[model samples]
Target: MAKSNERRTNIFPLALVTLTGLFLVNLLGFIDTQTGSAFGCGRDWPLCNGKIIPEVWNTHVAIEFIHRLVVLADLLLLLFLIAATYRRYRGRKDIRILMGISFLAFSGEGVLGAISVLTDNPPSVLALHMGMSLIAFTSLYLWTATLRQIETGKYQRFDLQDASSVKQLRKWTWGTLIYSFLVVYFGAYVTFTGAGGYFQGWPFPTESYSQAKTALLIDLTHRLMALILFVLILRLFLFTFRLRGKREDLRAVSLQTLILVVFQMLSGALLIITKLNLIAFLLHVSIATFMVGSLGLLGLKASSLQEKERMKEYNL
Candidate 1:
């Protein structure tokens, strides 16, 4: 308990800040990609034009250069947090496990990102970059919330007044988390395949449109995945809110999840309506990141119910 209190008081704020910084840097990366500055340095990575600072510079080069610098700083900060988590919370196996997972996912993202830069940003590589970012973001977000849970010892496990609701929350949240990852990957998949671009407008176009058979299939499948995700989340939200007993926390989670899904759908529309505008595209990715993170939070919270249930069986 003393250790938990010490960590809560000493380390949790830094964790939250680190999580936000990770999220922000990834957002910047997306903006850099959308703005077409990814090639600003002319395929020379780690150094722009073979100089620590480019002697000849333009807007694109400057953006890319600053982005690289920020990434270096972000990596350093994440490492510091990871080391601190190990030293300060080593006794807590759960926290250490989360730290390890976040570190590996983040490292994989960095590797993939570097590979893209060195390889002139291949379409297939770029398509998969955001998927790794999704994993890192979700892992770190869960770690942050878990740290707080450890500090305050607020499992809210005994608050599970309705066994049915907790069961539903756990089951549906697991499903949503898994399904959302596929949706994100397919979202990226459509971009590199040129499927989305070939199909103008979203949901239903103003008139009939035709495209290559493959492109049509990919684009339609992406939309179909989104529709299915929407239905699942909507059903979960209704279940979360309908619990007759005290499940306000789950209700709140449901509310946030529902809002993110709605905005994700809106951003998808904007991606088409704006003709794949850079900012709109960035918005689409940003919302998807947060929406996935929200469900990650739900999964973390849902675990507490299970843990408390086990405690009851132990007659503790």
Candidate 2:
């Protein structure tokens, strides 16, 4: 129990480290967008405007240029983490799997990034690129948590005999994650399509509602998903309360998910109401990133519980 408590305490800090890296990446992207530097490099892959080093230091050039460096830093950090954790927890399949996923997702993020630049920063491509980065970051969070578990020797497998509840939570969690990605994608679309400027006068567009409608639809879908997820989480928490001592870990994960989801929804709504103000935008993206990480953690907990239950049934 002492070891488990120690691991639980350490997990938050480690997760925060990974979250910091993700926040940096998100900030870089936001800076690029705010400065209209999406095409600053002029369709060059791994190069700044087709040169290893640009002789100029214009705003667009600087934003795009620095974003590249930030991505490089993130990649290196993830690689170092994988290497260090694998060396220490070489025998653990869970840790190995998490590391492998993180590496693969990082590689995919690099490819998507290159494609975004090569395609002249197409909206769809850019959106997908951000989505891929989020996946990589989520994997890193899971891996970091797993490493903490190993360090404190709190890595116990679960036995979840009530498969129905497990299945329900899994479905809801997965659905929420997917819907959140779509929200991000549409947000990118709004920026790239310049639809975000529709309400320049605030509240409503004076001329046409087309742009407003599209943005509203995107926002509404995200909001509906948030509501559904909240209900699902509340139900899960209530069920866990009934189960009490039997599923303490699962209950903890459920509560965390609920808290993060609520915050994410609020942040997103505030961003829009504030007219996409820079500070709110940053916080909005940060909360969304946190939500993704939380969802990933919940998924892992659920899967582990299911596996344990299956093993127990087989042994019986």
Candidate 3:
């Protein structure tokens, strides 16, 4: 019993470390992509330039190699977390579900990365790689945040007493998350497709080369979707802010989401104005990733709290 208690006590910090590692790996992977270094290791998987370590060091090789190393370390951390969670919280279906997702996403990300290296990383594959990394990162994040909430006893206040309201908020938050993810994905797709270069203006394409009409159209659609996402996030924030007295957690998450969306818009404009500058591009995608993850956290909490209300109503 004492050992189990000790393990539970340590879980939150361990999860936090693992989550941070995953986030760093995702950022490094994007850096690798943005730097056009995917082929740096010369179509090698689990090896750098046909060796465990590269015989030659160049900027591209260094970036890709470092990304792979970070991925390896993060995967080890995730595996340890999985084992710990199984031993300590095996009966927790939510924790188990999150672990399952984190495992699958990380695995998929690795496989995709390998395939991308082998295939020269076509635009679609590269985009999917980013998407998988985000999924893995978000799952671990959710797991860690859940542990923190439980440890701090903050989850107890999730009982809003009104199950219907919880359900409504959960649905709305989730729906918005889905839309935000689509927008993010399309933005990535636009980037990888090389369509972002055809646009000459922010919020609208001022001029288009004759051969780049499709690129222009795609970029325009991406901008429109972003506008709609901003409105959705704004509405979500207003609604949650009104309920601040009841669920400060949700209100805070909504505020964060709103702030991220605003920054995302600004970053988008920067990307356009700078003609897809690497820093601006990273900021745009990174903010969108966290924004979607924040909404996911909000929805998951409400969903869990709503379940508690259900059990209470049924006298379980």
Which of the numbered candidates is closest to the native, going by highest TM-score? 3
lDDT of 3: 0.81
Question: What would the TM-scores of all predictions be?
Answer: 0.88, 0.77, 0.92
Leading candidate by lDDT:
3
**lDDT of candidate 2 vs native?**
0.66
Give the per-residue lDDT of model 1 (tens digit) for 89-187: 676555666777888888888888778777867767887787888888888887788666665656444454576667767888988999999999989
- Per-candidate clashes, comma-separated: 0, 1, 0
Clashing pairs in 2: 160-309
lDDT of 2 by residue, 1-316 (tens): 1222332354445445655776687678877766678678878878887688877778888889888888787777666666656555565566677678777877887787777666656777777777777777777787776655445545444444766776776676666667666666666666566565445332233435464776655444445655666676576667556655766777787677678767866765666567777788778677767777777777776674435533443342
* lDDT rank order: 3, 1, 2
Q: What residue pairs clash in candidate 1, if any at all?
A: none
Least accurate stretch of 10 residues (summed lDDT) in model 3? 306-315
Q: For residues 177-240, could you state the per-residue lDDT of candidate 3 as single tens digits?
A: 8787788778878999899877767777787657577887788789899999999889888888
